[model samples]
Target: MTFRSFIARTRVLLGATALVLAGLPTAASADVVFQSVANPTDVTKFTSPWCSSCSNQYRIFDQFTLGSASSVTGFSVALYSLAPYWGSGLNFSIWTANGNVPGTELFSQSLGNADFTTTTLTGTALMATTDKVSGLNLDAGTYYVSFYNTNLAVWGYTGGGGNLLQQGNTYHTGTSADFILTNNVPEPASIALVGLALVGLGVARRRKA
Candidate 1:
Protein backbone atom coordinates (compact mmCIF):
# COMPACT_ATOMS: atom_id res chain seq x y z
CA MET A 1 0.00 0.00 0.00
CA THR A 2 1.16 3.61 -0.65
CA PHE A 3 2.50 5.53 2.36
CA ARG A 4 -0.36 8.05 2.12
CA SER A 5 -3.00 5.28 2.25
CA PHE A 6 -1.24 3.57 5.17
CA ILE A 7 -1.21 6.85 7.14
CA ALA A 8 -4.90 7.42 6.47
CA ARG A 9 -5.87 3.97 7.75
CA THR A 10 -3.73 4.43 10.87
CA ARG A 11 -5.44 7.75 11.70
CA VAL A 12 -8.87 6.13 11.44
CA LEU A 13 -7.83 3.27 13.67
CA LEU A 14 -6.41 5.65 16.30
CA GLY A 15 -9.54 7.79 16.24
CA ALA A 16 -11.78 4.78 16.83
CA THR A 17 -9.62 3.61 19.69
CA ALA A 18 -9.63 7.05 21.28
CA LEU A 19 -13.40 7.23 21.15
CA VAL A 20 -13.75 3.83 22.79
CA LEU A 21 -11.38 4.71 25.57
CA ALA A 22 -13.07 8.02 26.22
CA GLY A 23 -16.47 6.36 26.57
CA LEU A 24 -15.15 3.93 29.18
CA PRO A 25 -15.63 4.85 32.82
CA THR A 26 -12.67 5.08 35.18
CA ALA A 27 -12.24 1.93 37.25
CA ALA A 28 -12.57 2.37 40.98
CA SER A 29 -9.70 1.43 43.32
CA ALA A 30 -9.10 1.44 47.05
CA ASP A 31 -7.22 4.49 48.37
CA VAL A 32 -6.37 5.51 51.89
CA VAL A 33 -7.82 8.97 52.41
CA PHE A 34 -6.77 9.36 56.02
CA GLN A 35 -4.88 7.34 58.64
CA SER A 36 -4.32 8.25 62.27
CA VAL A 37 -1.48 6.40 63.97
CA ALA A 38 -1.64 5.23 67.57
CA ASN A 39 -0.49 7.75 70.16
CA PRO A 40 0.78 6.77 73.61
CA THR A 41 -0.41 9.75 75.65
CA ASP A 42 -3.98 9.71 74.32
CA VAL A 43 -6.66 8.13 76.47
CA THR A 44 -8.36 4.97 75.24
CA LYS A 45 -11.97 4.11 76.06
CA PHE A 46 -14.88 1.81 75.39
CA THR A 47 -17.06 3.76 72.98
CA SER A 48 -20.05 1.42 72.64
CA PRO A 49 -22.37 -0.68 74.76
CA TRP A 50 -21.64 -4.39 75.10
CA CYS A 51 -25.34 -5.25 75.10
CA SER A 52 -28.76 -3.80 74.31
CA SER A 53 -29.50 -2.87 77.94
CA CYS A 54 -26.03 -1.62 78.66
CA SER A 55 -26.00 1.97 79.90
CA ASN A 56 -22.27 2.51 79.39
CA GLN A 57 -22.09 3.65 75.83
CA TYR A 58 -19.64 6.12 74.25
CA ARG A 59 -18.41 7.64 70.95
CA ILE A 60 -15.25 9.14 69.41
CA PHE A 61 -14.44 11.57 66.58
CA ASP A 62 -11.50 12.30 64.33
CA GLN A 63 -10.73 14.90 61.65
CA PHE A 64 -9.62 14.44 58.02
CA THR A 65 -9.41 16.53 54.83
CA LEU A 66 -10.06 15.78 51.18
CA GLY A 67 -8.14 17.63 48.47
CA SER A 68 -10.66 16.71 45.79
CA ALA A 69 -14.08 15.20 45.42
CA SER A 70 -14.14 11.58 46.56
CA SER A 71 -16.42 8.64 47.28
CA VAL A 72 -15.74 6.68 50.47
CA THR A 73 -15.85 2.92 49.93
CA GLY A 74 -15.06 1.78 53.46
CA PHE A 75 -12.95 2.21 56.64
CA SER A 76 -10.73 0.17 58.94
CA VAL A 77 -10.19 0.64 62.66
CA ALA A 78 -8.06 -0.83 65.43
CA LEU A 79 -9.78 -2.44 68.39
CA TYR A 80 -8.47 -3.57 71.78
CA SER A 81 -10.85 -6.40 72.50
CA LEU A 82 -10.18 -9.56 74.42
CA ALA A 83 -10.89 -11.74 71.37
CA PRO A 84 -11.43 -11.39 67.67
CA TYR A 85 -15.05 -10.75 66.76
CA TRP A 86 -14.94 -10.80 63.01
CA GLY A 87 -18.06 -9.69 61.17
CA SER A 88 -19.41 -8.08 64.31
CA GLY A 89 -21.64 -4.98 64.23
CA LEU A 90 -20.43 -1.39 64.39
CA ASN A 91 -21.79 2.13 63.90
CA PHE A 92 -20.33 5.07 61.97
CA SER A 93 -21.15 8.75 61.59
CA ILE A 94 -19.71 11.51 59.41
CA TRP A 95 -20.03 15.22 59.98
CA THR A 96 -19.05 18.66 58.71
CA ALA A 97 -16.12 20.27 60.51
CA ASN A 98 -16.94 22.96 63.03
CA GLY A 99 -13.71 24.63 64.07
CA ASN A 100 -11.73 21.49 64.93
CA VAL A 101 -14.86 19.61 65.91
CA PRO A 102 -17.72 17.78 64.29
CA GLY A 103 -20.64 19.99 63.26
CA THR A 104 -23.64 18.89 61.21
CA GLU A 105 -24.07 15.17 60.85
CA LEU A 106 -23.92 14.00 57.25
CA PHE A 107 -24.09 10.22 57.46
CA SER A 108 -24.66 7.54 60.08
CA GLN A 109 -25.38 3.83 59.96
CA SER A 110 -24.89 0.44 61.56
CA LEU A 111 -22.64 -2.05 59.77
CA GLY A 112 -23.31 -5.74 60.28
CA ASN A 113 -21.73 -9.07 59.36
CA ALA A 114 -22.40 -8.59 55.68
CA ASP A 115 -20.41 -5.36 55.57
CA PHE A 116 -17.19 -6.25 57.37
CA THR A 117 -14.07 -8.44 57.39
CA THR A 118 -11.62 -8.78 60.27
CA THR A 119 -7.96 -9.57 61.02
CA THR A 120 -6.22 -10.24 64.30
CA LEU A 121 -2.53 -9.92 65.04
CA THR A 122 -0.65 -13.11 65.90
CA GLY A 123 -0.11 -13.78 69.62
CA THR A 124 -1.93 -10.57 70.49
CA ALA A 125 -5.58 -9.72 71.01
CA LEU A 126 -5.31 -6.61 68.80
CA MET A 127 -7.91 -6.82 66.05
CA ALA A 128 -8.52 -4.68 63.00
CA THR A 129 -11.83 -4.64 61.22
CA THR A 130 -12.62 -3.29 57.78
CA ASP A 131 -16.16 -2.44 56.76
CA LYS A 132 -17.61 -1.72 53.34
CA VAL A 133 -19.84 1.30 52.98
CA SER A 134 -22.34 2.27 50.31
CA GLY A 135 -20.27 5.01 48.67
CA LEU A 136 -20.46 8.31 50.55
CA ASN A 137 -19.79 11.19 48.17
CA LEU A 138 -18.25 14.40 49.46
CA ASP A 139 -16.79 17.57 48.04
CA ALA A 140 -13.28 18.89 48.69
CA GLY A 141 -13.36 19.99 52.29
CA THR A 142 -12.61 19.14 55.89
CA TYR A 143 -14.73 16.63 57.76
CA TYR A 144 -14.99 14.62 60.96
CA VAL A 145 -15.80 10.95 61.50
CA SER A 146 -17.04 9.12 64.58
CA PHE A 147 -17.67 5.42 65.13
CA TYR A 148 -18.15 2.71 67.73
CA ASN A 149 -18.72 -1.01 68.02
CA THR A 150 -22.37 -1.99 68.40
CA ASN A 151 -21.56 -4.69 70.95
CA LEU A 152 -17.86 -5.09 71.46
CA ALA A 153 -14.92 -3.94 73.56
CA VAL A 154 -13.06 -0.62 73.60
CA TRP A 155 -12.09 1.25 70.45
CA GLY A 156 -8.33 1.94 70.28
CA TYR A 157 -8.01 5.76 70.17
CA THR A 158 -6.16 8.79 71.41
CA GLY A 159 -8.78 10.52 73.57
CA GLY A 160 -7.51 14.03 72.87
CA GLY A 161 -3.95 13.13 71.86
CA GLY A 162 -2.43 15.80 74.11
CA ASN A 163 -4.68 18.43 72.60
CA LEU A 164 -6.30 19.79 75.76
CA LEU A 165 -8.73 21.98 73.83
CA GLN A 166 -10.47 18.84 72.56
CA GLN A 167 -13.49 18.05 74.70
CA GLY A 168 -15.22 14.81 75.80
CA ASN A 169 -14.35 11.70 77.82
CA THR A 170 -12.70 8.38 76.95
CA TYR A 171 -16.17 6.93 76.38
CA HIS A 172 -17.01 10.01 74.32
CA THR A 173 -13.79 11.68 73.23
CA GLY A 174 -13.18 14.72 71.06
CA THR A 175 -10.31 13.03 69.28
CA SER A 176 -9.80 9.77 67.43
CA ALA A 177 -7.68 6.64 67.31
CA ASP A 178 -5.69 4.53 64.86
CA PHE A 179 -7.89 4.12 61.78
CA ILE A 180 -8.00 4.54 58.03
CA LEU A 181 -10.61 5.74 55.53
CA THR A 182 -10.73 4.21 52.09
CA ASN A 183 -11.91 6.03 48.94
CA ASN A 184 -12.88 4.93 45.46
CA VAL A 185 -10.23 6.59 43.31
CA PRO A 186 -9.86 6.64 39.56
CA GLU A 187 -6.91 4.70 38.19
CA PRO A 188 -4.01 6.81 36.91
CA ALA A 189 -3.13 4.22 34.28
CA SER A 190 -6.22 5.20 32.28
CA ILE A 191 -4.46 8.34 31.08
CA ALA A 192 -1.39 6.36 30.05
CA LEU A 193 -3.53 4.18 27.76
CA VAL A 194 -4.02 7.12 25.42
CA GLY A 195 -0.30 7.80 25.30
CA LEU A 196 0.37 4.14 24.51
CA ALA A 197 -2.08 4.22 21.61
CA LEU A 198 -0.36 7.25 20.10
CA VAL A 199 3.06 5.58 20.45
CA GLY A 200 1.82 2.46 18.64
CA LEU A 201 0.52 4.58 15.75
CA GLY A 202 3.88 6.38 15.45
CA VAL A 203 5.76 3.05 15.37
CA ALA A 204 3.54 1.79 12.56
CA ARG A 205 3.97 4.99 10.48
CA ARG A 206 7.78 4.73 10.69
CA ARG A 207 7.67 1.09 9.47
CA LYS A 208 5.54 2.06 6.45
CA ALA A 209 7.93 4.89 5.47
Candidate 2:
Protein backbone atom coordinates (compact mmCIF):
# COMPACT_ATOMS: atom_id res chain seq x y z
CA MET A 1 0.00 0.00 0.00
CA THR A 2 3.05 2.29 0.52
CA PHE A 3 5.50 3.65 -2.18
CA ARG A 4 8.63 2.45 -0.31
CA SER A 5 7.04 -0.96 0.25
CA PHE A 6 6.45 -1.29 -3.55
CA ILE A 7 10.11 -0.53 -4.26
CA ALA A 8 11.20 -3.07 -1.65
CA ARG A 9 9.03 -5.78 -3.25
CA THR A 10 10.47 -4.96 -6.72
CA ARG A 11 13.98 -5.30 -5.35
CA VAL A 12 13.11 -8.69 -3.87
CA LEU A 13 11.78 -9.84 -7.29
CA LEU A 14 15.00 -8.65 -8.98
CA GLY A 15 17.12 -10.55 -6.48
CA ALA A 16 15.09 -13.71 -7.07
CA THR A 17 15.60 -13.32 -10.83
CA ALA A 18 19.34 -12.98 -10.33
CA LEU A 19 19.41 -16.13 -8.20
CA VAL A 20 17.54 -18.13 -10.84
CA LEU A 21 19.90 -16.93 -13.57
CA ALA A 22 22.92 -17.95 -11.53
CA GLY A 23 21.65 -21.53 -11.33
CA LEU A 24 21.31 -21.83 -15.13
CA PRO A 25 24.09 -23.28 -17.27
CA THR A 26 26.55 -20.98 -18.97
CA ALA A 27 26.09 -20.58 -22.74
CA ALA A 28 28.87 -21.16 -25.25
CA SER A 29 29.53 -18.81 -28.16
CA ALA A 30 31.90 -18.95 -31.12
CA ASP A 31 34.60 -16.34 -31.74
CA VAL A 32 37.79 -15.90 -33.75
CA VAL A 33 40.77 -17.46 -32.01
CA PHE A 34 43.21 -16.26 -34.65
CA GLN A 35 42.96 -13.89 -37.59
CA SER A 36 45.15 -12.73 -40.53
CA VAL A 37 44.95 -9.27 -42.02
CA ALA A 38 44.65 -9.23 -45.79
CA ASN A 39 47.26 -7.25 -47.69
CA PRO A 40 47.01 -6.56 -51.44
CA THR A 41 50.68 -5.78 -51.85
CA ASP A 42 51.88 -9.21 -50.61
CA VAL A 43 49.66 -11.75 -52.39
CA THR A 44 51.49 -15.10 -52.70
CA LYS A 45 50.69 -17.03 -55.86
CA PHE A 46 50.29 -20.83 -55.97
CA THR A 47 50.49 -22.20 -59.48
CA SER A 48 51.02 -25.78 -60.65
CA PRO A 49 53.75 -24.85 -63.10
CA TRP A 50 55.76 -22.97 -60.48
CA CYS A 51 55.60 -25.90 -58.08
CA SER A 52 55.82 -28.81 -60.52
CA SER A 53 58.20 -30.73 -58.31
CA CYS A 54 56.00 -30.26 -55.27
CA SER A 55 54.40 -33.59 -54.46
CA ASN A 56 52.00 -34.54 -51.67
CA GLN A 57 54.66 -33.26 -49.25
CA TYR A 58 54.38 -29.61 -50.19
CA ARG A 59 51.60 -27.60 -48.54
CA ILE A 60 51.31 -23.90 -47.89
CA PHE A 61 51.59 -23.00 -44.23
CA ASP A 62 50.72 -19.84 -42.32
CA GLN A 63 51.96 -19.38 -38.79
CA PHE A 64 50.06 -18.44 -35.61
CA THR A 65 50.71 -18.35 -31.88
CA LEU A 66 48.46 -18.77 -28.86
CA GLY A 67 49.15 -16.94 -25.63
CA SER A 68 47.05 -19.39 -23.64
CA ALA A 69 45.40 -22.79 -24.08
CA SER A 70 42.44 -22.96 -26.50
CA SER A 71 39.73 -25.21 -27.92
CA VAL A 72 39.44 -24.63 -31.64
CA THR A 73 36.23 -25.68 -33.40
CA GLY A 74 36.40 -24.35 -36.97
CA PHE A 75 38.26 -22.32 -39.60
CA SER A 76 37.77 -20.39 -42.87
CA VAL A 77 39.96 -19.12 -45.68
CA ALA A 78 39.74 -16.63 -48.53
CA LEU A 79 40.62 -18.14 -51.92
CA TYR A 80 40.68 -17.04 -55.54
CA SER A 81 41.67 -18.15 -59.03
CA LEU A 82 42.91 -16.32 -62.10
CA ALA A 83 41.66 -19.25 -64.17
CA PRO A 84 37.98 -19.76 -65.02
CA TYR A 85 37.25 -22.58 -62.53
CA TRP A 86 37.80 -23.00 -58.83
CA GLY A 87 39.63 -26.05 -57.41
CA SER A 88 38.06 -29.36 -56.47
CA GLY A 89 38.87 -29.45 -52.77
CA LEU A 90 41.39 -28.51 -50.13
CA ASN A 91 43.31 -30.56 -47.56
CA PHE A 92 43.73 -28.54 -44.38
CA SER A 93 45.99 -29.28 -41.45
CA ILE A 94 47.23 -27.76 -38.20
CA TRP A 95 50.79 -28.38 -37.19
CA THR A 96 53.22 -27.64 -34.39
CA ALA A 97 55.96 -25.19 -35.27
CA ASN A 98 59.55 -26.53 -35.38
CA GLY A 99 61.47 -23.33 -35.01
CA ASN A 100 60.21 -21.44 -38.12
CA VAL A 101 58.84 -24.50 -39.97
CA PRO A 102 55.83 -26.74 -39.56
CA GLY A 103 56.95 -29.69 -37.44
CA THR A 104 54.34 -32.19 -36.32
CA GLU A 105 50.83 -32.55 -37.67
CA LEU A 106 48.16 -32.06 -35.05
CA PHE A 107 44.92 -32.31 -37.09
CA SER A 108 43.95 -32.51 -40.74
CA GLN A 109 40.85 -32.92 -42.93
CA SER A 110 39.63 -32.59 -46.48
CA LEU A 111 36.92 -30.15 -47.48
CA GLY A 112 35.30 -30.72 -50.87
CA ASN A 113 34.25 -28.10 -53.39
CA ALA A 114 30.59 -28.56 -52.40
CA ASP A 115 31.50 -27.76 -48.81
CA PHE A 116 32.55 -24.28 -49.87
CA THR A 117 29.74 -21.74 -49.96
CA THR A 118 30.47 -19.80 -53.12
CA THR A 119 30.46 -16.04 -52.57
CA THR A 120 31.76 -13.50 -55.05
CA LEU A 121 34.10 -10.73 -53.99
CA THR A 122 34.76 -9.24 -57.44
CA GLY A 123 32.46 -11.02 -59.92
CA THR A 124 33.50 -14.61 -59.08
CA ALA A 125 37.14 -13.67 -58.81
CA LEU A 126 37.52 -14.19 -55.02
CA MET A 127 35.69 -16.58 -52.71
CA ALA A 128 35.86 -18.13 -49.25
CA THR A 129 35.12 -21.46 -47.53
CA THR A 130 34.04 -22.32 -44.01
CA ASP A 131 34.12 -25.70 -42.26
CA LYS A 132 33.62 -26.96 -38.73
CA VAL A 133 36.32 -29.01 -37.03
CA SER A 134 36.25 -31.31 -34.05
CA GLY A 135 37.34 -29.09 -31.16
CA LEU A 136 41.14 -29.30 -31.12
CA ASN A 137 42.73 -28.62 -27.75
CA LEU A 138 46.01 -26.71 -27.98
CA ASP A 139 48.41 -25.37 -25.38
CA ALA A 140 50.03 -21.95 -25.51
CA GLY A 141 52.64 -22.12 -28.28
CA THR A 142 53.48 -21.40 -31.90
CA TYR A 143 51.70 -23.32 -34.67
CA TYR A 144 50.98 -23.41 -38.40
CA VAL A 145 48.00 -24.14 -40.62
CA SER A 146 48.71 -25.88 -43.89
CA PHE A 147 46.57 -26.01 -47.03
CA TYR A 148 46.86 -28.26 -50.09
CA ASN A 149 44.62 -27.40 -53.00
CA THR A 150 43.58 -30.44 -55.05
CA ASN A 151 43.70 -28.40 -58.20
CA LEU A 152 45.49 -25.32 -59.53
CA ALA A 153 43.04 -22.87 -57.97
CA VAL A 154 45.01 -20.42 -55.87
CA TRP A 155 44.88 -20.25 -52.09
CA GLY A 156 45.06 -16.55 -51.34
CA TYR A 157 47.90 -15.33 -49.12
CA THR A 158 50.04 -12.26 -48.80
CA GLY A 159 53.66 -12.74 -47.72
CA GLY A 160 53.25 -9.12 -46.78
CA GLY A 161 49.85 -9.68 -45.12
CA GLY A 162 49.57 -8.16 -41.67
CA ASN A 163 49.38 -10.38 -38.61
CA LEU A 164 46.16 -9.12 -37.11
CA LEU A 165 46.45 -11.32 -34.02
CA GLN A 166 50.01 -10.04 -33.47
CA GLN A 167 51.16 -13.64 -32.86
CA GLY A 168 52.00 -14.91 -36.35
CA ASN A 169 52.93 -14.21 -39.93
CA THR A 170 50.71 -13.86 -43.02
CA TYR A 171 52.31 -16.43 -45.32
CA HIS A 172 55.13 -18.96 -45.62
CA THR A 173 56.99 -20.45 -48.59
CA GLY A 174 55.10 -18.36 -51.18
CA THR A 175 52.46 -21.09 -51.65
CA SER A 176 51.44 -21.11 -47.99
CA ALA A 177 48.01 -19.60 -47.12
CA ASP A 178 46.23 -17.77 -44.33
CA PHE A 179 42.97 -18.50 -42.52
CA ILE A 180 40.83 -17.62 -39.46
CA LEU A 181 40.42 -20.02 -36.57
CA THR A 182 37.35 -20.09 -34.34
CA ASN A 183 36.70 -21.45 -30.86
CA ASN A 184 33.82 -21.81 -28.45
CA VAL A 185 33.90 -19.31 -25.59
CA PRO A 186 31.86 -19.87 -22.45
CA GLU A 187 29.67 -16.92 -21.36
CA PRO A 188 28.32 -17.05 -17.79
CA ALA A 189 24.64 -16.18 -17.39
CA SER A 190 25.33 -15.04 -13.82
CA ILE A 191 27.36 -12.10 -15.08
CA ALA A 192 24.45 -10.76 -17.11
CA LEU A 193 22.09 -11.27 -14.19
CA VAL A 194 24.40 -9.32 -11.88
CA GLY A 195 24.52 -6.46 -14.39
CA LEU A 196 20.72 -6.34 -14.57
CA ALA A 197 20.47 -6.34 -10.77
CA LEU A 198 22.88 -3.38 -10.52
CA VAL A 199 20.87 -1.39 -13.09
CA GLY A 200 17.64 -2.10 -11.18
CA LEU A 201 19.26 -0.95 -7.92
CA GLY A 202 20.40 2.31 -9.59
CA VAL A 203 16.83 3.03 -10.80
CA ALA A 204 15.40 2.34 -7.33
CA ARG A 205 17.92 4.69 -5.68
CA ARG A 206 17.02 7.52 -8.12
CA ARG A 207 13.29 7.04 -7.50
CA LYS A 208 13.76 7.13 -3.71
CA ALA A 209 15.74 10.39 -3.94
Candidate 3:
Protein backbone atom coordinates (compact mmCIF):
# COMPACT_ATOMS: atom_id res chain seq x y z
CA MET A 1 0.00 0.00 0.00
CA THR A 2 1.12 3.60 -0.63
CA PHE A 3 2.59 5.52 2.36
CA ARG A 4 -0.30 8.02 2.20
CA SER A 5 -2.86 5.18 2.31
CA PHE A 6 -1.15 3.64 5.39
CA ILE A 7 -1.28 7.03 7.16
CA ALA A 8 -5.00 7.36 6.40
CA ARG A 9 -5.76 3.91 7.88
CA THR A 10 -3.81 4.76 11.07
CA ARG A 11 -5.77 7.95 11.47
CA VAL A 12 -9.07 6.08 11.14
CA LEU A 13 -7.99 3.57 13.79
CA LEU A 14 -7.02 6.39 16.18
CA GLY A 15 -10.41 8.06 15.72
CA ALA A 16 -12.25 4.84 16.58
CA THR A 17 -10.12 4.37 19.69
CA ALA A 18 -10.95 7.90 20.80
CA LEU A 19 -14.68 7.28 20.44
CA VAL A 20 -14.52 4.15 22.62
CA LEU A 21 -12.48 5.98 25.24
CA ALA A 22 -15.05 8.73 25.41
CA GLY A 23 -17.74 6.21 26.34
CA LEU A 24 -15.76 4.74 29.25
CA PRO A 25 -17.26 5.11 32.70
CA THR A 26 -16.33 8.07 34.87
CA ALA A 27 -17.54 9.26 38.26
CA ALA A 28 -18.32 12.73 36.95
CA SER A 29 -21.05 11.42 34.62
CA ALA A 30 -22.95 9.38 37.21
CA ASP A 31 -26.70 10.05 37.58
CA VAL A 32 -27.68 12.07 40.67
CA VAL A 33 -31.19 13.22 39.88
CA PHE A 34 -34.48 12.23 41.53
CA GLN A 35 -36.05 9.13 39.99
CA SER A 36 -39.07 6.96 40.75
CA VAL A 37 -38.65 3.43 41.98
CA ALA A 38 -40.19 0.47 40.21
CA ASN A 39 -42.62 -0.47 42.98
CA PRO A 40 -43.43 2.80 44.69
CA THR A 41 -46.90 4.23 44.15
CA ASP A 42 -45.84 7.73 45.15
CA VAL A 43 -42.69 9.55 46.26
CA THR A 44 -41.96 13.09 47.38
CA LYS A 45 -38.99 14.99 48.81
CA PHE A 46 -39.64 18.02 50.99
CA THR A 47 -37.41 20.74 52.45
CA SER A 48 -37.39 24.42 53.52
CA PRO A 49 -35.97 27.12 55.77
CA TRP A 50 -35.82 26.54 59.53
CA CYS A 51 -38.46 28.73 61.16
CA SER A 52 -41.59 28.50 63.30
CA SER A 53 -43.91 29.99 60.66
CA CYS A 54 -42.51 27.88 57.81
CA SER A 55 -45.18 25.25 58.39
CA ASN A 56 -45.72 24.49 54.73
CA GLN A 57 -42.84 22.05 54.96
CA TYR A 58 -44.72 20.27 57.72
CA ARG A 59 -48.22 20.22 56.28
CA ILE A 60 -47.37 18.74 52.88
CA PHE A 61 -46.89 15.27 54.36
CA ASP A 62 -50.30 15.29 56.02
CA GLN A 63 -51.99 13.97 52.90
CA PHE A 64 -49.68 11.14 51.80
CA THR A 65 -48.36 7.81 53.08
CA LEU A 66 -44.58 7.49 53.32
CA GLY A 67 -42.18 4.56 53.81
CA SER A 68 -43.13 1.22 52.31
CA ALA A 69 -41.47 -2.19 52.26
CA SER A 70 -38.78 -0.93 49.87
CA SER A 71 -37.24 2.01 51.71
CA VAL A 72 -35.34 4.67 49.81
CA THR A 73 -31.67 3.75 49.69
CA GLY A 74 -29.97 6.76 48.15
CA PHE A 75 -32.35 9.60 49.08
CA SER A 76 -30.71 12.75 50.38
CA VAL A 77 -31.72 16.27 51.38
CA ALA A 78 -29.60 19.42 51.82
CA LEU A 79 -30.59 22.19 54.25
CA TYR A 80 -29.41 25.77 53.98
CA SER A 81 -29.85 28.65 56.44
CA LEU A 82 -29.28 32.03 54.79
CA ALA A 83 -29.54 34.40 57.73
CA PRO A 84 -26.41 35.35 59.64
CA TYR A 85 -27.10 35.37 63.32
CA TRP A 86 -24.62 34.65 66.08
CA GLY A 87 -25.28 31.54 68.12
CA SER A 88 -28.01 30.61 65.66
CA GLY A 89 -28.65 26.97 64.91
CA LEU A 90 -30.94 24.87 62.69
CA ASN A 91 -32.90 21.80 63.74
CA PHE A 92 -34.06 19.40 61.04
CA SER A 93 -35.88 16.05 61.02
CA ILE A 94 -37.20 13.53 58.50
CA TRP A 95 -40.56 11.83 58.92
CA THR A 96 -42.72 9.37 57.02
CA ALA A 97 -46.25 10.62 56.36
CA ASN A 98 -49.26 8.48 57.25
CA GLY A 99 -52.62 10.07 56.44
CA ASN A 100 -52.08 13.62 57.75
CA VAL A 101 -49.84 12.44 60.54
CA PRO A 102 -46.06 12.17 60.45
CA GLY A 103 -45.09 8.56 61.13
CA THR A 104 -41.62 7.17 61.67
CA GLU A 105 -38.69 9.55 62.12
CA LEU A 106 -36.16 8.64 59.45
CA PHE A 107 -33.28 10.86 60.48
CA SER A 108 -32.48 14.09 62.30
CA GLN A 109 -29.63 16.57 62.68
CA SER A 110 -28.99 19.90 64.34
CA LEU A 111 -26.41 22.42 63.26
CA GLY A 112 -25.20 24.41 66.21
CA ASN A 113 -23.88 28.00 66.09
CA ALA A 114 -20.55 26.70 64.85
CA ASP A 115 -22.11 25.01 61.81
CA PHE A 116 -23.58 28.26 60.40
CA THR A 117 -21.94 31.57 59.62
CA THR A 118 -23.10 34.65 57.72
CA THR A 119 -19.58 35.94 57.17
CA THR A 120 -18.55 33.08 54.87
CA LEU A 121 -21.76 31.05 54.52
CA THR A 122 -22.49 29.79 51.01
CA GLY A 123 -24.50 26.59 51.73
CA THR A 124 -21.51 24.35 51.21
CA ALA A 125 -21.15 22.81 54.65
CA LEU A 126 -24.70 21.53 54.70
CA MET A 127 -24.53 20.04 51.22
CA ALA A 128 -21.25 18.28 51.83
CA THR A 129 -22.51 16.38 54.84
CA THR A 130 -23.88 12.97 53.77
CA ASP A 131 -27.41 12.08 54.79
CA LYS A 132 -27.42 10.15 58.03
CA VAL A 133 -30.24 8.02 56.62
CA SER A 134 -28.48 6.53 53.62
CA GLY A 135 -29.69 2.88 53.53
CA LEU A 136 -32.79 2.66 55.69
CA ASN A 137 -34.96 -0.40 54.99
CA LEU A 138 -38.48 0.99 55.09
CA ASP A 139 -41.52 0.54 52.84
CA ALA A 140 -42.03 2.77 49.82
CA GLY A 141 -44.61 5.52 50.32
CA THR A 142 -45.09 9.28 50.32
CA TYR A 143 -42.77 10.89 52.88
CA TYR A 144 -42.37 14.35 54.34
CA VAL A 145 -39.17 15.86 55.74
CA SER A 146 -39.50 18.89 58.02
CA PHE A 147 -37.23 21.66 59.34
CA TYR A 148 -37.77 23.80 62.39
CA ASN A 149 -36.04 26.31 64.65
CA THR A 150 -35.94 24.35 67.88
CA ASN A 151 -34.03 27.11 69.64
CA LEU A 152 -36.46 29.84 68.68
CA ALA A 153 -35.51 32.02 71.61
CA VAL A 154 -31.79 31.87 70.91
CA TRP A 155 -31.66 31.43 67.12
CA GLY A 156 -34.66 33.59 66.23
CA TYR A 157 -34.12 36.58 63.94
CA THR A 158 -36.71 39.05 62.66
CA GLY A 159 -36.33 41.56 59.90
CA GLY A 160 -36.36 45.40 60.43
CA GLY A 161 -34.46 45.25 63.71
CA GLY A 162 -32.27 48.18 64.68
CA ASN A 163 -28.52 48.14 63.86
CA LEU A 164 -26.03 45.92 65.71
CA LEU A 165 -28.37 43.87 67.83
CA GLN A 166 -27.46 40.92 70.08
CA GLN A 167 -26.37 37.61 68.59
CA GLY A 168 -29.33 35.86 66.94
CA ASN A 169 -31.25 39.14 67.38
CA THR A 170 -30.63 40.69 63.99
CA TYR A 171 -33.31 40.89 61.31
CA HIS A 172 -31.83 37.95 59.46
CA THR A 173 -34.97 35.91 59.02
CA GLY A 174 -34.73 32.38 57.60
CA THR A 175 -35.86 33.13 54.06
CA SER A 176 -32.89 31.81 52.13
CA ALA A 177 -33.13 28.16 53.06
CA ASP A 178 -33.62 25.50 50.37
CA PHE A 179 -33.56 21.73 49.91
CA ILE A 180 -32.95 19.32 47.00
CA LEU A 181 -33.94 15.67 46.70
CA THR A 182 -32.00 13.33 44.42
CA ASN A 183 -31.86 9.60 43.68
CA ASN A 184 -28.38 8.16 43.87
CA VAL A 185 -29.20 4.54 43.14
CA PRO A 186 -28.70 3.29 39.61
CA GLU A 187 -31.29 1.06 37.96
CA PRO A 188 -30.43 -2.60 38.40
CA ALA A 189 -30.51 -3.37 34.67
CA SER A 190 -29.14 -0.08 33.30
CA ILE A 191 -25.55 -1.22 33.12
CA ALA A 192 -26.47 -4.58 31.59
CA LEU A 193 -28.63 -2.90 28.96
CA VAL A 194 -25.90 -0.49 27.92
CA GLY A 195 -23.35 -3.31 27.68
CA LEU A 196 -25.66 -5.48 25.61
CA ALA A 197 -26.39 -2.65 23.20
CA LEU A 198 -22.70 -1.96 22.67
CA VAL A 199 -21.99 -5.64 22.10
CA GLY A 200 -24.81 -5.97 19.58
CA LEU A 201 -23.57 -2.96 17.68
CA GLY A 202 -20.12 -4.48 17.44
CA VAL A 203 -21.45 -7.83 16.30
CA ALA A 204 -23.60 -6.23 13.60
CA ARG A 205 -20.69 -4.20 12.31
CA ARG A 206 -18.55 -7.34 12.03
CA ARG A 207 -21.29 -9.21 10.12
CA LYS A 208 -21.57 -6.32 7.65
CA ALA A 209 -17.83 -6.47 7.02
- For all the candidates, what are their Cα RMSDs to the real structure? 8.5, 9.9, 13.2
Query: Against the unseen true structure, what C-alpha lDDT does each candidate score?
Result: 0.58, 0.59, 0.37
* Candidate 1: tens digits of C-alpha lDDT, residues 26-106: 675778766665442232342332221123343556677778887777887655444343336667778888886668999
Q: Write the per-residue lDDT of candidate 3 for residues 114-193, one digit (tens) a residue.
A: 54323222342133122333444445566544444532311211221111112222223322122323334444344544
Against the true structure, candidate 3 reaches a TM-score of 0.34
Q: List the residue pairs that clash in candidate 1.
A: none
Error of model 2, residue 34, in angstroms: 0.1
For each of the candidates, give the backbone clash count.
0, 1, 7
| Candidate 1 weakest lDDT stretch, 10 residues | 46-55
Clashing pairs in 2: 60-176
Tens digits of lDDT, candidate 2, 1-209: 57678778778877877787768777656687776644422333322222211343344566788878887876666555444235566677788878766778999887776766655544334545564567588899889776566343334443423221112322324433446677865567756766776868876786877
Cα lDDT of model 3 overall?
0.37
Number of the candidate with higher TM-score, 2 or 3: 2
lDDT of 1 at 170: 33
